[model samples]
Target chain A: MTATDRQATGATWLRRNRQVVAPVLFLLPGLLFFLVYVLLPVAQSVQISFFRWDGLGEPDYVGLANYRELAGDRAFEVSVINNVKWLLLYLLAIPGGLFIALFLNQTVTGIRLYKSLFFFPFVISQVVVGLVFTWFYDPTFGLLNAILGAVGLGPVNVLGDPALATYGIIVAGLWPQVAYCMILYLTGLNAVDPEQVEAARLDGAKGWRMLWYVILPQLRPATFIAFVVTIIGALRSFDLISVMTNGGPFGSTRVLSFYMFEKALGEYGFRMGYGAAIAVVLFLIMLVFIAYFLWSMWRQERGA
Target chain B: MKTAWTTTAALALLAALPATAQDESLSGTLTIFSDMSNPAPRAVMEDMAARFDEMHPDLEVELTIIEREAYKTQIRNFLTANPPDVANWYAANRMRPYIEAGLFEDVSDLWAEPEIAENLASTKSALTVDDKQWGVPYTYYQWGVFYRADIYEEHGLEEPADWEGLKSNCQTLLDAGTKCFAIGTKFLWTAGGWFDYINMRTNGYDFHMQLTNGQVPWTDERVRTTFANWRELIDMGAFIDNHQSYSWQEALPFMVNGDAAAYLMGNFAVAPMREAGLTDDQLGFYQFPLIDPDLPMAEDAPTDTFHIPSGAENKEAARAFLRFVVSPENQTLINGGDALGQLPVNAASEVDEDKFLEEGFEMLSANAPGGIAQFFDRDAPAEMASVAMEGFQEFMVFPDNLDDILGRLEQARQRIY
Candidate 1:
C-alpha cells in the first residue's frame, strides 16, 4: 500500500506481471510437495535397485544380480503370470461398469438408492472386502461352497487351490472395481450434451449404435480415468491378496507388488535390494504404458 | 582462559545439585518396545511391566506394544533411527543378524553379574551368538501333537510310540469316521512343524540341526527318509480333508469338535481350543511319535526374548527391566491363564497346575534327551525357512511332488547358504 514498501520489494517486472507471478507462487508449494514425496522416493527406489541391501545395513553393490535371481525364481514367474491375468481380466470392469451405469441410468422410483447400493463395495474398505470375499470362498463353510453343494457339486477350495486362487482374488477385486468404473460412467453420462444426442437420435443413431458412436465418444474422459484406475488397481493388487490368501496355498496368489513387499519388509528376512529390483521392474512396466499414454495425449492435443 | 572459567562455573553449578538425583537407583523414563500384541500375552506383559514399576517406584516405564507382523519390520528401522531402551525380539538366528550389525547390545554382563544366567541356562544357548548373550529369553513354549484324550481312550490308542503306533492310530481313527490329524497349511508354518518333528525323529537331533542349518543338503538320504515317513501320513489320509483351506487357528474346530483326533501345533493353540469349548481333561499333550525309534526325540520350542538396543539412552534402566523380567516371580504370570499358556525359560519359575503344562514340562524333559529344536522357521534362516515352509505345504497338498520339492529346496538352500 506504501510507495516505500513497494520500492523495497525487488523484481518490478514480476510485480507488474501479477498473473504469471501469482500462478507460479501458488504452484510452488504443491510442486515442492509432489517432488519431495513422490518423485524423490521413485528416484531413490531406482537408485536402490542396483545395490544388494537388507534394509538395515550398508547396501552391497550387486549390479544386476537381483534381477538375474528374479529371472529364475518360480515364485516370480507365478506372480508375473498372475499379474498378467489380473491386467487382462481387470479390463472387464470398464464394460461391466458401463452396462450397469446404462441399466440404472433411467428415472425409476428409488433409482438413487439403487445406484448407491450398487456402489456399496467401492465405499467399503478394501480390507473388509477381502475378508468378506475370503469367507465367501471358504471351502468348508462358505457361501460359494454351500451353493456348489446345493447344486450337487463337490465343495471347491477356491483360495486353497493354487490353480484357482488368483482367479478367485481377481473376481473379488473386480466387485469393487466395477463399482468404481460404474460411478465414473454415471457422472460422465450426466455431463453428456443433450443437443448432440438429439441430433444423433434424429439421424437414426439408436440402441448399440447410439451408445457406440454418439454416447461413448462423450464419455471418453470417464473411460480414460476408469482404464487408468483399473490398471493401477491390477498392478498394485496388495491388500486384497494380503487379506484373502497372503500369497499362500503355496505362494500362488502373489503379485509383483506383494512379492516386492514380502522380500523387502516381510519376515522372509530383509532383502531390500531384491525388493527394489522387483519394484524397478514393475515401475518400468508402468512407465512404458504411461509414456505411451502421455505421447498419445500429446498427439491428441496437437491435433486438436 | 575464558573456556576454563566457563567450565569451572558449569562444574560449580553441577556440584550444587541434589545428591538424590545422582543416585544409581534408576529413576527415569524407560521406553520399552514390545511385540506381545496378542490379548493374553500382551496382558501378561503389561502385568509384568506394572509389577516392575511397582518394584522400582521411582522408575516410570513407558511400554509401546506393536502388532506382531508390523513390529518385525519396524523394529529394525527403530533400532537404527530412534530406539526404545528395551525391545522384545526372538532368540537364535532371528537375533543373529541384529547382533552382528551391532543393533542389539551384548548384555553378557547381566548374565554373569546377577547370576541370572545360571537360572536360565537352558535358554542361554539360544540367546547366545558368538559365545556372548545378546538377549534375555524370557518365554518359550513346547510344540507337539495335541490330542483329544477322550477320543484316544475310546479308540484304545495308547500314546503313539513309533511309526507303527501312529499308523494304527490313524487307521483306527479313519475307521471310526474321525480324521487322524487336523493340519492347516494355509499359513504354511504348520507344515514346517510337521517337517521339523519327522526330520528330528527320523534322523535324530544332530541330523535335523545339520539339515536345518544347511550343513546337509536337501537331496541327502536322511531327508528322503523323513519325507517318506511324511508320505505315509499323507497316503493314509492322516490329515483332515481340505487342510490346505484353513489356517492353524481355523483348523482347531476339527480338534474341538472331535472330528479330528490331534493337531501338531505349539502350546499357544490350547487357548483357542479351550475357547472353542474343549475342557482340560479332553485336551492332552504328547510329543510327536518316534519314526526311527533309535533316534532321540526333539521338541519344537520357539523362544521369545527381550534385549537392549545398542542405541538405548537408558542402558541402566533397560538392564533393570531385564532383571525384573528374568525373575521367577514375573515368569509365572505367563501361565496365570486357564488356557493361554507359554512356558517360562527360568528354571526356578513356579510350575503351573494345568495338566497340559505339566505334561509339556514332563514330555520336554523325558523325551527330548537328544536336544530341542526352535521350530523349523526359527531353526533355519528366515530366507531358507520361507522356501522350506512353502515346499512342505506344497508336499502336503501334492505328496507325489516330494522329489521336486526337495530339489527346489536344495536350489534355494544353495542360493541362500
Candidate 2:
C-alpha cells in the first residue's frame, strides 16, 4: 500500500478512539500500582484492626477489642499527647523559616553561599541529624549540658526526662523542617512581583505591616505549602525519635508513628493488629487535616 | 540394556546422596543470617565459615551478617519468607515465639549426638522447650558489677556481700564524691539487667521464671518488694545523675574515669572498658550483692544459640554448621583464649581463663542455691519485657512515680497476656 494510505488509516483510527480508550490506557499502570500498593494495604490494615494477629499465625477475630485496648493503654495516651505536642511545636518552623528567609532576602556579596549554608540542615538526613543532636544533648559531657553547666543553669537531661524528651526530638526535627520552609519561602520570594512591593512601599507600608499585609498576602502559596508540609512532617516524625530515644525515657517520646513501629516490628513482639489500629488513628488524623488543606487550596485555586 | 544398568546404578547413588545421619559429602548452599556484625567477632565468624567451607569442599555456605538491631526485626519476616538455613538468636524466651510459630526446626536429634550433647549439657535446659531441644547455645557471658578496684581501695570500700555492706560502700563512695553505680538506661534493656538482679534476688529463680512466664502478677506483693529494694539505691543517689542521657557504653566512662566506682554489665563490656584505658589491675569483677539472705542466688547469663529454620533447604548442612560452631577449636577462636572475656557454652572448651570469667563462673555456679536465670528480657515474653523494662527506666528517673509505673505495667500485663 502507498504511504498516504497507511497514514490516512492511522489518523482515522486515532480519531475514532481518542476519547474513551486513550484515557483508560493512560491511567492503567499508575492506577493498578496505587490500588495494589497503597489502597490494598490500607484496606487490609483496617480489616486487621478488628482482629488479634501476631504477623505470624492465624489472626483471631476479636472485633473492636484492639481499639478498646487502646482506650486503656497508658503508653498510647502518652504517644497521642506527645504527637499533639509535636504538631503544636512543629508549627514554629513555619515562622522560623519565614524569619530566616526575610533576613537572607537581600542580594548581597556571597549571599548565595549564605543561603546554601542556611539550607544545610534540610540537606542532612534525619538519621544523621538525630545522632548529632543526641550527642549534643548528652547530659554528662554534651555540648548543651556543658554550656548549661558553664552558665550554672542546667545540665538537664533533655532527651531523658519524660517531660522534656519529646520536645528535644521535635527541636531536632524542626532544624531540618525550618530549613525546608526557608527554601520554600525563598522560591516564593523570588516569584514576588517587584512592582507590587514598590507600590505598597509608596503607600506607607513598612516593616511589620509591609510583611503582614503586602508580602504575606503575595506569599500565600508559599505559606500554604509550608503549613501543609509542616503538619505532615510533624505527624511523620519517626526517625528523629527513633534515633534520639527509641521512644524511650518511659516511652514518653513516642509519636503515633514510632508507637506503631514499636508495636508492629520492634522487640516488643508482634502485635500487628494493635499497630494497625494505631496506624488507622494516625490516618484519620491526617485525613482530617488533608481535607482542610485541600479545601483551602481549592478556594485559592478558584479565586486565582 | 547395559547402558540402562549403568544409568540405574548412577541414579541409585544420587538417591543415597543426602543421608539422614552425618554425611561427609553433603553438597548444597547453606545460608546463615548472623547478627555478629562487630569487627572482631565478625572476622572470627567469617574465618569459621571459610574453614567449614574448606572442610566440606562441595558444600557452599553463605554467611550474611546483619546489623544486630536490624536483624531482630528482619528475622521475624525472613523466617517465613525465603528463610535461611541457619540463624543465630538468644536461647530462651527470645526463641520461643519462633519455635511456637514452627519457624525453627526442633533440633532434638542434634542434641542427641553424644559429643555436642556432652559439651552443651549445662545449656540443655536453656535450649529446650516442651521436652524437646530447639537450639544449640554456642556462647554466653556473665552479668555482674565490674568496679574500679583502685578506687575501692582508696576509698576503703570493701566488695559488698550483702545489702547492708553494699549500702555502706555506696555511702562511703558518695562521701568521697564518687557515684556507686554507673548505668545508662536510654536503650531500656540496660534497666532490664537491674530488674533481673532485683527480681532474682527478691524472689528466687523459680519465682523469676514463674513471673516471667506470666504465672505471677505485677500486683503481687513480691514484685512490689523487688521495686522497693531497687528504689533504695535510687533514693540514695547511688547512680550517675541523668543516666537516661547515655547508652550503656556511653556511661562506661564514668566508671573507667573513677568518677563512678561500679558497673552492672555483661562480661562483653570488658573490651570497651579496657578500650577506655582501664587496666585489668584497676578493674575488678564481683557478683551483684546479696539482697535477701534466705532467697537463693541466681545470675543473668544470656546464651547465644544457632537454630535451623524449618524452611531450610539443606538441613544436613545446617546441622553441620551448628556442630562446627560449637566445636572446641571454633569456640576458643571466637572467645579468644584469655582475651575477650566471653564464655563459650561448650563445657569442654579450654578458653575463658581470664580473671573476670573465672570470677564470674565461680559466682554463677558455686555459691548459688538456685541455678542461673536468663536476663529479665530474655526470660520474659518480648512484649511484657518491653513494658517492664520501660517501667524500670521510668522508676529510675522518678522514684516517686513507682506506684503509677507499676499500675501502668499491670495494665500492659493484662492486655498483652
Candidate 3:
C-alpha cells in the first residue's frame, strides 16, 4: 500500500513541475544570448588585460609589465586626476537638475512642452553636444566671445588655456546630464506623498527645513539613480573628449577613457599591449567604486 | 523547445556554409577601401571601375568611398582582418610602418613598366620604402599661401617675395580691418604646415631632411629660429585667433567672404575655395616668402599613394588595379579634372586645356626647386610627430617658454629613436 502511494505521489510531483520546467527551457535561449554577447566580452576584456597584444597578430603573455609601465606614465597620472575632476564636477548636475525640476514643477500652460524642450539635449548624441560647445568656445565670432566684447571685458581663451579647457568641456558635458537628472527628480516629485508635506507644514516646517526633513528623504531613490549615472558618465567620458579636443592643447582634456583610446587605437602607433595595460588599470580603479556601490546596495536590500 | 531546435538548426546551417563567400571564377567582385569619398573622385573611380568591368567582364570592381577620418580607422581594421583587394595611403613615412610589418605587397615589378616608371620619377622615392616600392603614387598637391586677390588689391599689396615683405603685407591687411590670415589648427596638421614653411625657408632642404630623419636635435638653433619666426607672426596679430577651434574646411569661409585675406594651405584648398563661391579672379596662390631668398626651394608637397595589403584575397586583381591607377590613361582621367587640382604622377598624361589644371601644373613645374616631402611630422615616426606637434603648439601659445618646449621636444625625439 505504501509503495503504490509513493509511486502515485511521484507521478503527481512530475506533472506539477512541468510548468517550472517549461519556463526554464524558454529562459535558457535568452540567458545564453546575454552570456555570449555581454558577459563573455567583458570577461575577455578583463582576461586580455593580463597579456600584451596589438589589435593585429597574436598577443604575447606579459606578467603585469603593462601595469608596471602605466604606473610611470605621467600622461596616465594626468588622465586619472582629470577623471576625478570629471566625477566630482559631474555630480553638480544632480542638484542643479533637482533645483530646475522644483522651479518648473508648476502647471502653467505648455509646461509639459517646456519639460520636454528642456530635456532635448539629453536625447541628441554627445558628439553633437561636443561640436556645439566647441563652436561656442571659439575665440573669434563665437557667442561667448561676442558677449565678452559687448561687456567690454577682454576675451578669455576658454579651450586654448590648459587650466580652463577641462572645466570647459565638463560644463559642456553637464548640459545633457542635468537634463537627465531633472527628469528623474520630476518623476520622484510626482510620487512624493502629499499628506506628509501637509503634516510637516502644520508643524511649522518650511523652505530648507521642510525640504531637508520631508522632501529630500522622499527623493532618495531618484538621487541614487542620478548619482550612479553621473558617476558612470563622468568615468566613461570619451566621445566628447574625442570630438571636442582629441585630448589636445597638450593632452589637457584627456580623461582615462580617452587616454585608453589614444594608447590603444589612435595614431600613437598600435601599442595594444600598452593600451590593455591602461584598460586593466582603469578597470581596477573603477572596480573600487563599483565594489563600494555593490556593498551599499546589498546592505539596503538586507534592510528592506 | 521550439526555439532551442530553431537555434540548433541555424547554427548547423551556419557551420555548414563554405569558407569562401565569392562565386567560383577568375572574374569575381573586388572591393576597394578608398578615402576619396568626394563626389568628383567617386565618379571618376566609378567610371574607371565600369571600364575595367567591361574589359574583364567576369571580374567586378566594388569601390567603397569612405570618409577621411573614418577611413583611417577602417583601413587599419581591414588590413588587420579581411583586407580589401586594394587601398589608398600616404607615401613616405605614413606607409613605413605598414611596409615594415609586411602588411603591404611589394609592387616593385609594377614600377618597372616603362610608363609607370617614367611617370613616378619625381615621387618614386616616396613610394619606394626601404628600396622596395610598396605602392603606386596617384595624386599630389603643392602647398603654399593662398590669398584673396581683392583684399590684396584693396590694401595695395602684391604677392610678397621675402619674409619681411610678407610681414609688411600682413600688417597692411590687418590695419585695413581684414584678418591677415585664416588658420585652423584644431586638427593639429594646419599648425604643422606653418612650422614646415618657417623651417623650410630658414633652414632649407638639408636641415629639413635632418630634422625629419631624427638626425638633428629638435632643440637645434635652426629649429628654434623657425619657431621664433612663427612667434613673430603670432605677436604681430598677423594670424587669426582661435585657429585651433576650426578645421581648414570650416575656416575657408573666412577667406571666401574676405574676412581673412590669406590662407596658408595646400592646393586642395583651391577646390574648397571654388566650392565656397570664390572665383579664380578672387583667389590667388603664392610660394611662402623665404627668409633667405637665395636658399634653394624644397617642395613641401605631400603625395597620395595606394598599396595592396599583404593578406589581400585578390592579389592579382589588386596589382592590376594599382597598375591601372598609375597607367597614363587613368592618371589623365584623375588629374585632368578641375576637382583633383594636381599634376599627374604619370608623365604621359596630357594636361588638358582645362584652366584650373593649368594653375596647378604651372605651380608644380616652375616653383619646385627640388622635390621635398611635406614636413617633419609626416616624415618622422608617428610617435615623434605627435610630440613634436605638441611642442610646436606650446611654443606658438607661449613663445617666451621656447627653451622649455625645445628641451621637451629633444627629450621626445630621444624617446622615439
lDDT of 2 by residue, A1-304 (tens): 9999999999999989889779999999999999999899999989999988888878899999999989978889988999899999999999999999999999899999999999999998999999999989887678998898888995688988888888888899999999999999999999999999999999999999999988999898899999999999999999998889988888888989999988988777589999999999999999999999989888978998
What residue runs in model 1 are displaced by over 4 Å at the alpha carbon? A1-11, A199-205, B1-24, B338-340
Q: What DockQ does every candidate get? A: 0.65, 0.73, 0.34
lDDT of 2 by residue, B140-165 (tens): 88899999999999987788999899
Q: Of the candidates shown, which would achieve the greatest DockQ relative to the real structure?
A: 2
Candidate number with the higher DockQ (1 or 3): 1
Among all windows of 10 consecutive residues in model 3 chain A, the one with the lowest summed lDDT is: A49-58
Candidate ordering by DockQ (highest first): 2, 1, 3
**Each model's number of backbone clashes?**
0, 0, 0
TM-score of chain A of 3: 0.89
TM-score: model 2 vs. ground truth:
0.93
Candidate 3 chain B lowest-lDDT run of ten = B16-25
- Candidates ranked by lDDT, best first? 2, 1, 3
Tens digits of per-residue lDDT, candidate 3, B1-417, equal: 999867655554453343212222235677888888787777766776666555554577888888876777677788878788889888888888777667899989988988678777888887877788999888877778888888898878999989999989988887888888898766677878888788888888778878888899977877878887888888987767666656788788788888899998877777778878988888887878778777876667788888899888888888777877787777877776554657677777766564445665676667767556755567877777876776676666667878977886787677567
lDDT (10s digit) by residue, model 3, range A72-111: 6667888999999999999999999999999888989999
